[model samples]
Target: MDEALWAFGRASGVVALVLFTASIVLGIITRSGRLLPGLPRFSVTLVHRNVSLVGSVFILLHVGSLLLDSYAKLNVTDIVVPFIGSYKPFWQGLGTVAVDLLIAIIVTSLLRQRLGVKVFRAVHWFSYAMWPIAMVHAIGNGTDGTSSWFLLLAAVCTLAVGTALIWRLSSRFVESARLRQESV
Candidate 1:
């Protein structure tokens, strides 16, 4: 039973990380106002939203399995509050922080109509912070952290996100410069 729980936790965590990576990339694309080759603009937004929701579910499974596994030593408090877990406190705390930020993002999204776009976007920006925190937590605290495969996975995820972020920023800068030149 313990082994099963441990396996479940690890697998779920990996899946969650992959899903979140997809969400981040898709979100950057959506924000850039460029339609994917076969996907409409709205389709890209929908895909991003669905990927994020699925990633949250995987995150819940990962945490729940860890809580059940004696090896993880996680309690309810450890999930909600940061830096107080008996096992890998700092790394676990980073995961906790990521979860907290995720909660805020989810809540704001659900209430977007009532809360207003500004509030939703402000909270959504937490994704930038949340993704890296979660990645560090996975690599630092995971049992297979030092394994070659895991490291490769982490590197791939990093490269994908880094590329997307660079594209987003550079495009935005170019657009700004173009607007300034036109105005001049």
Candidate 2:
């Protein structure tokens, strides 16, 4: 029973990370062409936005379950603060980092208008950081890290997130050059 619950927790964590990656991809796709420069990026942005919201919800559930699980050995404070989890402070600290990143993402998203375009866009980039942090937490601290199913899940999660992030970053240079040439 305990193992099953742990597996579920890990699965939810992976699900949340996958959703976050989708959101990042769609966001880059949907942004303004002149400002963002992309191939058919808008619709995906909406999908990304919606999916990210759902991902956040799932992540909340994942954290909640971890705290609830007797085997996890995580206190409520451990979930919030970094390097404080007694079970495995170094690796679990990834969760702390992720939580902070999530809070920043949420705040900026909510106050996007107030934050303005430059600040909002800048902070938005950090969402990319959050995915890896969460992934590290799952892999390093999760009990199922060595399990075959968990390994597969981690691979998919990492691939999806890494691809989206790489595309987003790489396309920036290409887009900039394209815009520059067009202007010339």
Against the hidden reference, what TM-scores do the models get? Answer: 0.92, 0.79
lDDT of each: 0.90, 0.74
What is the alpha-carbon lDDT for the whole of candidate 2? 0.74
Off by over 4 Å in 2: 1-5, 32-42, 171-184
lDDT of 1 by residue, 17-87 (tens): 99999999988877665678988767988999999999999999999999999988899999999999998
* Cα RMSD (angstroms) for every candidate in the order listed: 4.0, 4.7
Q: Provide the lDDT at 115 for model 2.
A: 76
Name the best candidate (by TM-score).
1
Quote the RMSD, in angstroms, for model 1. Answer: 4.0
The per-residue C-alpha lDDT of model 1 at residue 5 equals 98
Location of the lowest summed lDDT over 10 successive residues in candidate 2: 32-41
**Which residue pairs of candidate 2 clash?**
23-48, 26-44, 26-45, 29-41, 30-41, 30-42
